[model samples]
Target: MYHYDEYDRALVFERVAQFRDQVQRFTAGELSEEEFLPLRLQNGLYLQKHAYMLRVAIPYGTLGARQMRTLASIARDYDRGYGHFTTRQNIQFNWVELAQVPDILQRLAEVDMHAIQTSGNCVRNITTEAFAGVAADEIIDPRPLAEILRQWSTINPEFLFLPRKFKIAICSARQDRAAIMMHDIGLYLYRDGRQQMRLRVMVGGGLGRTPILGLQIREGLPWEHLLSYVEAILRVYNRHGRRDNKYKARIKILVKALGIEAFAREVEQEWQHIKDGPAQLTEAEFQRVAEGFAPPRYAAQPDGDLDYGTHLAMDRSFARWVSRNVQPHKVAGYASVVLSTKPGPAAPPGDLTAEQMDNVADWSEHFGFGEIRIAHEQNLILPDVRKADLYPLWRLACEQGLGTANIGLLTDIIACPGGDFCALANAKSIPIAQAIQSRFDDLDYLHDLGELSLNISGCINACGHHHIGNIGILGVDKNGSEWYQVTLGGAQGKASALGKVIGPSFSAAEIPRVIEQIVATYCAYRELDEPFVDTVARVGLEPFKERVYARQPEVSTCAM
Candidate 1:
């Protein structure tokens, strides 16, 4: 929701012009592919298996209605009719033309959007919770600080090229919807007894070949030191992080090699050098960035609305949707509505057609403020929908295929494009996700099963964030064939933990049935009203593994 000032506009326009020339040079063969590689990557362009994929950044996952429409136009005009919303809260166009990229950048610039720092080994998009300011249980709004981080890091010559991609996430809510624990740097924003803002800093968290939760490096850090502390961590990483091996380049690996104590000492030493430097955030700057995210005007309404209660009582389907997809808001008589992008086999998880995008943009204005949010779980959000507008909005959303009642259920899976679009993928993730969704189409059953997450990744890159799902499925390569590996008890949020692998990898055809057995095993052993993850924690992985492998055919040994 932060509108670009003249400086921001000039920076984006200049970048577009520079990239246009670079693109022209490459097209004319004046620049070699090797020369163009980093240039293109810095601009959020990737050469995938079939075509170039363009990833556009949605700063802190906030989007104005106009920006959403612009994205829809790009999807319609430039690539295929649809775009994939990634777990990072960014959207990817899988089939983009090499020549039209500059034009696309220009279009994005018109709406204060760009792809800068989205793909390069730089600080990627600074993400926060989708329900940042509006969540009922929020301690303090994190978007202002998130925006500050974004501005400070964008194109900072000191950190233009790091050993590997770095990600940072901040959250202020009681529930961690942003999955901050799995980021390179995670910040929990809160207020102390005196209402002085503070941060709990975590570092060295990442998911790839090696998945590890972040270790808390600092607690009760004053809000003024947010940027300074982050810079100190980056300086430490830039100096000591491995550059010889890509697999070992992430800060997580560095933190692992050096124990947390040593890592903390190094960061502390680095911070002492820059603690009071220009990077330290100031009150004036904080207020300037925060003005853009100030609360929207609202009409005073009662705690309960008669029409809303009437609709919920009359329509069971609407009630089910409200139960699963709606969230409490900070303001009375309002709620945050999650528009699920996962709609079973009709579309892949995290994908929306141009038409759907346009519809959402329209609905955003009609229902609430002209704002939309992209969730880390690959869903769209209307953060301030009035309770009185719930029924009409739900009807409109249902008409556009955006109303799926499975928010944290099995079918509401988080998945990457996998082998279908990404060359780095060893196996196909889309089909597997579709297969699982198709198998678990019963909404009643899913709701009864309680909140569960199923995440899939095509490879070890963990693009789908499979390691943190309640039931994680990873695609593995076995003798040039694709095999699926299952991990149980993974979870995100406050008690985030990485999943443990079951015995062996199963063939693609066996994934659905394997998931079925896992679910059945959970149902058998679960205590009354226990969530899937809690059941896994109570019963452990042995029972699910026993049931899955008991009646299965011979399978290859675990390779991952």
Candidate 2:
């Protein structure tokens, strides 16, 4: 994890004080609701359906024990007892009081965290894979470059307010766990033939009303020009991205209007002015950032644990969990464990209580380094847990309701807090997600079904990233009622693709059965060991669509 220096500390504290005064002014009627809107948004405060929601940035989804504890404290002291981890690798504290926001910001700042750039139409949090450094297939650790981008973008006067919110994600692993192609700017760090770091830059990729996979604009870009290159891209977008309509303001729209070739040319032309400027990274600066994320000390141990295998064979439940939740780590004796936040029907997806947060912090320290990672899938990750200690950690995690063992299964859903909390939501997403979870609660069935991603979004803002789910469900407004529109064949990773809509929207009551039918269709068409996305691609969406709308009259598709 990157520790905040004096400058970072000063900037955060100063912003806190400034927001404190702004909140005071708003409360005292010195600022109207309209006047306070942008100011509050800039500080990551949103006036939701019932109360204010504060989104705190967990930069690159990395958290130290102290930072996690501080977040738990904030959740305990101020808002409701729990917070929701978002797809952007940030956490949202819903039900926060307007007046207490300053205090919450203060508490966050104390732990070297802040809500800065978590919201507002500016460059948001720079996210990366949860297993960035520890992933077995990684060419190089991306956290150093992520940290550099973070420092460069944070409060940069040139990009404070873009045409719309800008999101950038970096992935260095062979598997694109960070969903890089679904972001405004996606950077893939890799080593060239000479073993020097380089970037493959993807632009115009985002999920919203208009979901588009990013196009690779520049390949094999030297890592030294990352900041300058990013500046060039942003500068082009800032100059040409639409401001007349919010829906058309994103860089994706600009990229769509102008083809990738023209867009790349414009960026290259712009890059000529700034490519070799001070923003060009130097060896010392790179090393300075890289030092913050050096690998943790590890004890020498055998590659595989006999005891771990014994425990797996002994307990079927434990075996199931280990299969789904455990991931390969770069280290010989270490493994990354994803603690599922989506335990069952009762809990909303990606939600954790304050106590759960504290327990995870304790577990992170007890099991490995005092470090925690928030996966883009809305799960907690202990990146360096010893294989020998897996059973004990699993037991502790089970006790806390964080051991759901549904990592890539249907039950491990990605859903936004829809009409329940968010004012922008058209339909209630949580209940729908719960319905799906309840319908598919059997772990064996889910595991047998295999490696399926089900995502739901309340609206087309795509907070839940429904566009990329193997089975994507988007809530739509039909007349005055809420309905769901399903999309299939979407996937994330090296072969990322946006899902295609199956057919008409269905009522909320019909969603689970629809999902069940979709699953059944996949099972029927799939070959041995075929993943859901692969099956969808092979057979196309026609079979699923035919079955889904077989009994019901097709309702007209509407805006999600």
Candidate 3:
């Protein structure tokens, strides 16, 4: 994890002081709500349905034990006893008091963390794969560049206020776990013919009312010019992106209005002047950032543990967990364990109690380096857990209700804090997610169904990234009543594709059964060993749509 230097510390503390004063002024009636809106948003404070929500950035989803402990402390002391881990690789305290926000920011600063850029129409948190350095198949570790982008964008005067919120994600693995193509700016880091690091830049990709996959704009971009290149892209968008309408303000809209070729041409024209500017990364500067993410020390152990295999054979439950929760690590004898936040009906998706956070933090230190990772899927990850100690760690995790063996299963849902908390939401997301999880509570059935992603967004904002889920459920407003619209064939990774809507929306009570019917339809149509997304793609959405709506009531006519 990247530790803050004096400069980082100074900037955060100063920002905290500034926000403290801003809050005081707003409370004193010296500043209007409109005036304080951006100020509070920049500091990661949002006035939600019932209370203020504070979103704290976990840079590139990496967290040290101390930072995790501090987050747990904040959750316990400042707001509710739990916090929701978001799809953006950040955490949200949903019940925070308005007056206590500065104190929260100050507390976060103490641990080299803050809510800066977590919200607002500025560049938000730069996210990457949860298993960046540890992934066995990763071509390069993206943390250094992710951290660089984080620092560069933080409070950058040029991009402080873009037409809309900008998001950038980097992925270096063969599998695009970072969902790079779904970002405003996505970078795929790789090497060229001369073994020189380069990037493949994708632009205009976003999920909202208008969901579109990013188009590759620039290829073989030298790694040294990352900052300058990004600056050029931002310059293009800032100049031409719509300012009149919030819905049309996104770079995706601009890119759509002007084709990718013209957009690329503009960016290229803009880049020539600044290509060799000071922002061009030097070898030394690269090394300085890279040093922060250097691999942790590891003990010499056999490539495969006999005891691990023995334990798996002995306990079917443990074996099932290993198959799902545990992922391959780059180093021998190490595994990355995903602690599922969606554990049946006990908790909503991504909601973790303060005690659970502290326990995971403890386990990160106990089982691996004192590090934790937040996956974009709203799960916690211990990136370097030893295979030899897997059983003990699994037992401890199970005790804490974090040992749900559904990593990519249907129940491992990715959902937003919808109408329950977010004022922007149209319908409640948590209850829907909980209902689905409860319906699919059987671990055997989930595993048998194979890998599947079910994502629900309360609205078209796509906060849950529903467009890329194998089965995407979006809450829609129909006569002031809660309804869900389902989509199929969406997928993330190397073959990322936006899902297509099946048909009409269904009522909230009909969602669980609709999902069950969808899954059943997939089971009937799928080829042997075919993944859910692949099956949906092969057969199309008609089969599932028919099944979901068959014998169903006329939901469109229903009123609240």
Taken over the whole model, the C-alpha lDDT of each candidate is 0.93, 0.92, 0.92
Task: Report the Cα lDDT for candidate 2.
Answer: 0.92
What TM-score would you give candidate 1 relative to the actual structure? Answer: 0.98
Q: Which stretches of candidate 2 lie over 4 Å from their true place?
A: 552-560
Report the candidate with higher lDDT, 1 versus 3.
Answer: 1
Q: TM-score of model 3 relative to the true fold?
A: 0.98
lDDT of 3: 0.92
- lDDT tens per residue, model 3, 417-447: 9999889988988899999988888888778
Compute each candidate's TM-score over C-alphas.
Answer: 0.98, 0.97, 0.98
Angstrom error at residue 395, model 2: 0.6
Writing each residue's lDDT as its tens digit, candidate 2 over 121-216 gives 899999999999999998899999999999999999999989999999999988889999998999999999999898999999999899999999
* Residue 480 displacement in candidate 2 (angstroms): 1.2
Please give the range of 10 consecutive residues that has the lowest summed lDDT in model 3: 551-560
lDDT of 3 at 117: 90
Question: lDDT tens string, model 1, 49-116?
Answer: 99999999998999999999999999999998999998898999999999999999999999999999
TM-score of 2: 0.97
- The 10 consecutive residues of candidate 2 with the worst lDDT sum are 551-560
